[model samples]
Target: MSESKPGFRPAMTWLHSWAGLVLGLLLMTIWWTGTLSVFDKEIDRWMQPETRIAAPEQRISADAIVERVLTERPDGTLSSLLIYLPEERVPFYEVHAEFENAESYRGRLHPGTGEELGDEVSLAASGFLYPMHYRLHSGAVGYIAVALATFMMMVLLVTGVVIHRKIFTDFFTFRANRKSRRSTLDLHNVTGTIFLPFHFLICLSGFAIFAGWYASIPLSFVQLADPENRAVELFYAADNDAYYSREAAGEPAEMLAMAPMVAQAETIWRDRYGVEAKADRIDVTHYGDANAVVEVRRHFPSNRTEAHRDSINFDGATGAVLTNFEASPLRKTRTWLEGFHQVRFDHWPIRWLYLVAGLSGCVLIGTGFLFWAASRRRKEAAQPFKVRLVDTIAVGSITGLVLATGAFLVVNRVLPLDAAALGIERAGLEVRCFFYVWLLTFVHAAIRKQRAWMEQCRAIAVLAVSAVALNWLTTGDHLLAAIGKDLWPIVGVDLSLLSTALIAALAAGRLRSKMRQVEEAAVATHRRDMGSPSGAAGTVANRAE
Candidate 1:
């Protein structure tokens, strides 16, 4: 067959190669991180072992937390607050408050101290990574990137299906040791094809999660009439029906006590549905003011339904009931989707499945990166600066990101808990540690050449292992302790990190060895070929003679 001949279908050939070439790594990172994000809370629990406390009445009434918050920051707009009961795995009553002249909001919390947990506000760092994968943390830019990535993902999906006409037959095909473009193609197709359903749903749902922001631009006029002001704005609007007046606001209205309120809320939920609802949070607005509404929200679950679920209403000034909205159909649907998407409500089995899927997705993307590098390596030496720049970003951002995240966990353990005394907030320090490490990795990748890739991978392996060791150092229990206590989060997260480190170390070793072998073989071939007169030249000279 003529190598130059355009025998293979042009569109299919281009789609198969370029699609994998373009989106492989990013797709992997998004999938893996997203999977991890499902259990972001669990990971946090593993990292900050100190926060775990036995179920206690340590949960202050939502009303009390609100009252305390108002006393301190009178001008700050209270957005949301919740006090999780002791039985809940992650304990923290969070207060979302917005200060004047600030475009963004902040969450405040008090760490668990056997006694009264004070309202020492801090940013929600660990929980934020879950959203950051898709939402990206970059206000407008992040969402834009997600939206674009989703669109591209859709393109890859469509092209993938089209090019692989026999996708189903090849779905289970994975040939290890085959050395040809066809084998690479098969590997790419099998991974992409088998996970097509998962990829589609995750991508679509991820985009849908932010649908209000992205899809509401053309419908701004529609939102103008709607109070919530966005597409799929199904969350029950905060009931502002409470009677409020400047003069009457300070009236002596004894707000409903939280203990009874909790009992009553749980009773109402159970009696109404014959199910025990885990009330992780309650929101009370206008604490001392006449119009206080008690909003009860459920904790995060990996389950599809009841993820973003909450029920709320206005309680009269004198602790009398005023208004309430039971979970509606639309609200229920949103909750279900959000829950599955967030994996907030997932139990152990579902979480494991998600983890495996996430890892597979990461593999898909990582392979794509390798494919690109392998294909371009010979041409890379002659490529333009722009091409080289992109290559650098690919290497740095992909591998470097993993290391940076591990480093953040390490910093969290090392940084003194008394961060305030040192004029540094723990959350700020953590964020800086993550970003700075990533920044350094990027710079290091640009200057260090191929060696940087290996070095960084080795660093990632080391940091990951060190992070696992640090857990044992900081907390005596480690995986063994978690196993004894049957704490799956700690056990799973710790072991998973350790396993990842070993896998990474093995990969680095193999890559380094392979690179060394390739270099040696190339040198040997050069010496052997050039050691004697060229056979071709000698043959021509003899013919001329």
Candidate 2:
């Protein structure tokens, strides 16, 4: 106060602008990948053609699938087996088995035929892009980065509203016809202000999804004396007390058929919820032993907004219900937030809306990057390298990131099932394509400067269209074929790719026009300076492209 300190609004303004600028790149990556992950399962189906079949009217039995799994591998003493039953969205049986020797097996089977699918050659969205959203595929480090970014996002949203004197007005105040810097700011304000509540909630819910990580902090201290890292295990053990398990008796027992047990569990849930309910997964422990227990878990139902995994355990031999587990109140609250963030509930309209909101987050973050670069370029005009560097990063992160994703999809379609090099499988090769293409975009942006934006947009358009065409060529599932076969997931992905191509092409054309205008202006300024005795030092070219 004695020295005339800045007011609250001014402090918030500085915080908002600087914080956003500092972590904007990370935010954009998270937001874009998160947006794509809204339909990760759909993308999975589109990428893996063997999983694109329609749901069978008459389904195979859970008992039969289990029997087949055991028959396929008779050597190892069974440790545990998981059967993921088919649903409307994913119409296939998936099995994962673990033997006492630690050998594991995974396969996808046809719903009607129960025939195991060929080996999956690709690590589609569920494996890659979805994880990239929350973890960046870097494990603990990625988790921390995303957590920090999410926290900063919430802070930015608050500071942005405080600094924006006309926050509500900004919702309808986009001036698309204004000058470049002003319109960019306006667009940023509009997106940020329009989705203020949503942005806040999404960020907040993200924290809940990672609540376990936060819990590990205190639990780690609690387990300081232990040699093993059991903080997470302890956290779950205390919170998940309802789970029931029994040790193997070592006496061989013919386990009751799992089909009846599965039906009984579904019927109980359906009766309790007054709606259709089905077992999402069945987990078995100590198979072939008297104490073996079959646990059936139901997710995405039994409740809509909790992401609750309601489970019921049945005795191995008699198939009698052992424990109908229910989560604690605190657990339910966390799960509710998890469900809200995950959007895995059974609602079609809201699912599509989540997609729109997620993309809007991408737009909000991208526009913020643009606004900062544009405003800074004017004041830092003399530092050409600095301005160009900022422009290059902006171009590479926004358009280039998206272009890399398009290339990833295209490469997935182009690579043969047996594609491998230097011991890397086809899935690993596809990941390499994504990273290498992304790295090249940065180099390309630095070389092309202002022209990079338009050039990359064109590349994105080509890659997107090529992905769709290649999907048709390789799988013979064009838009029409998918529609005829009622393969809506494939159709949805194809249409989205075409839409992306169209949008990228349009953006390319606009950038080309803007580039022409900038060059023409620079030429005029140079001509004016050439005729003067003492030439003006600065030109439009020095300021911006």
The 0-to-1 C-alpha lDDT of every candidate, in the order given, reads: 0.61, 0.84
| Per-residue lDDT of candidate 2, residues 479-534 (tens digit) | 99999998888889999999999999998998888877766776677687776522
Q: Which number leads on TM-score?
A: 2
Residue-wise lDDT of candidate 1 within 114-205, one digit each (tens)?
Answer: 23343232223354566567766677887787677777777777766765667768888877656433455667677777777877777776
Local error of candidate 2 at 299, Å? 2.3
| Residue 274 error, candidate 2, Å | 2.7
**Residue clash pairs of candidate 2:** none
